[model samples]
Target: MNVRQDIHSAGVPVLCQSCEARHRGLCGALEPDQLVELSKTASRHGVSPGAELMGDAEVVERYSNVLSGVVKLTKSLSDGRQQIVGLQFAPDFLGRPFKSESAINAEAATEVSLCSFPRTVIERMMRVSPGFEHRLLKQALNDLDEARDWMVALGRKTASERVASFLLMIARNIEPASDPAARSASFDLPLTRADIADFLGLTIETVSRQLTRLRTDDVIRIESNRHVTVDSLSRLQQRCGD
Candidate 1:
């Protein structure tokens, strides 16, 4: 990742223009000149896997776009139990708008690169740009919908079904839209087995056993603990009861 320490680049405009999220996320509503202005206040950073982007209960004064990789949103109970509530992928916006602090832990699930700006800047942008605010609202609604769906999965799905459903979700999200013929999808699992257990509301042993069962059944191919290759998304989805 190109670290934007200076917050100014010789080709900032070009860089913003070529950004993957340029037309798909918050920046999509900005005009070319507006992008040029916004780039001046923007900075980019690469976050190592497992690092905290935002801690639970920490004051959040900045906003960011996930330029690449995944981030996990986690929450911990007073009794010390923690759960993985949601996952954020590339091009997703980070930070809660109109709020002063984070309610969940935001951790890098993979090597992540982000483009960030001050929260004040974003709030200001929303005030003047209806299109930008509208986009943010849309994103918020989508995130809420996903969260509710996952809640249902965690509360009602069977163990094997949960594992299969998890895999299907990851496969769908990680697959590139440009690759229509990618009959099989391969990627490293962003979360550890323990983390997966928390996310699926299962025990570590159960998660491992289910994963092995999936591999044995030819629903997936596990090259290593983290490396996973799904032979057929359709089969995985079937296992997920999709």
Candidate 2:
């Protein structure tokens, strides 16, 4: 898993003010000097689609804040059945602090960029910085809340509703440097039909039918099998019954 060396920027210390994740992620909790210290150990990485970022039970040596694209958190059973437990978006932190091994497998759902640093550095910082600790705690709670909501969607919602709900979630979350003023948006499906099926707890055929149904009803426009364009956010939300 040797990445291109060019992708690794020399850890020249930098300020937090210009970081994209400064206000939204872990960097938001850091003071000026602390930010510089973090920069010294942090490097940027570009991950290709389908690459395994971390594996279940693997030692956690480093942590990353996702800069762009989607990551799927998966869990496998003893029988080899796999489930997509969760999805992480840009500016979301990855890795478990204070834990030696990962609980789930994290794979890149699309081409992704990350700001990564050693786990020990983050752990040490958390011990001394209450703000950092609070931010991590808040992030954990938010993830828990989202997990609970997904549990309801999977357990109570119909197949079609589940598909619509997934689409709506992506539409709201996936932003790719688009015009902030634009109400309409378009992005490629980061996960394949099979992957989506695993995530939604449906068969591939069921997932295909639901997507076609959405397109036929004019809720969305599809180009290549992977590309999706939503005409209106409100219309998509309405179809999701949200």
Candidate 3:
């Protein structure tokens, strides 16, 4: 009758039967039997905000799926300056494949839930499962496309537009299945103002000023500094300079 019921009827492992990743992420490519086999070594865990899930050049031991909450991907300069390169949301895969060490640092931006499996298990599956490999490729390509779009925003967009675009990106990704016609959305910001400023290549003051402008214009509402409610997604999109 519903998605949960359908998953139950499919007889997948209990751990995966209700997982969003099982339906929309790489696990979607696996058969029920495969899921059962994979679940033998899979583990679910919670990570608090500010926790480092993986570090730059860290030895790869496991791969994970973001079951809930946000993860930030960052790159550091030799001088110790770090840039927020990307954000990962629920159902997104959380590691690099075929690499012995990670190239970027991944940190939890909010209270996060993850389902992790040993690196060898996933790599072995990829070698044997064409569907699994294809799903991974598709995600990689999608990330590349998003990175390119963000490059344009950072390189050419004004401070105001960049802020709007960043907010729009978070709203869209945080709830990928949100109804398009609803034209409204609300969610807590996954990153702090400083992190947002770094991601958008703007000063913290500029980010706050633009956010205040958006609030004054009725494009969005901010509560308690982190929660954001976009009153009109269309109006917000209009400000993005897309």
For each candidate, how many residue pairs have backbone atoms clashing (under 3 Å)? 0, 0, 0
Candidate 3, after superposition: displacement of residue 237 in Å? 0.6
The candidate maximizing lDDT is 3
| Residue pairs whose backbone atoms clash in candidate 3 | none
Clashes of 2: 0
lDDT of 1 by residue, 134-184 (tens): 989999999999888887887788999999998877776663522445567
Off by over 4 Å in 3: 1-9, 175-182
- Judging by TM-score against the true structure, name the best candidate: 3
The alpha-carbon deviation from the true structure for residue 197 of candidate 3, after best TM-score superposition, in angstroms, is 0.6
Report the C-alpha lDDT of model 3 over 1-242, residue by residue, as the tens digit.
Answer: 13244344566877897799988899999988788778888989999999999999999999999999999999999999999999999899999999999999999999999999999999999998999999999999999999999999989999999999999888877864244466788999989999999999989999999999999999999999998998778899999999
- TM-scores for all predictions: 0.90, 0.89, 0.94
The better-scoring model by lDDT among 1 and 3 is 3
Residue pairs of candidate 2 with colliding backbone atoms: none
Error of 2 at 38 (Å): 0.4
lDDT by residue for model 2 (1-242), tens: 21232122433234344555776888888876677677768888899999999999999999998888999999988898888999998788999987899999999999988899999899988998899889899999999999998999899888888998898778767766234455676889889999999999999999999999999999899998988998887777776654
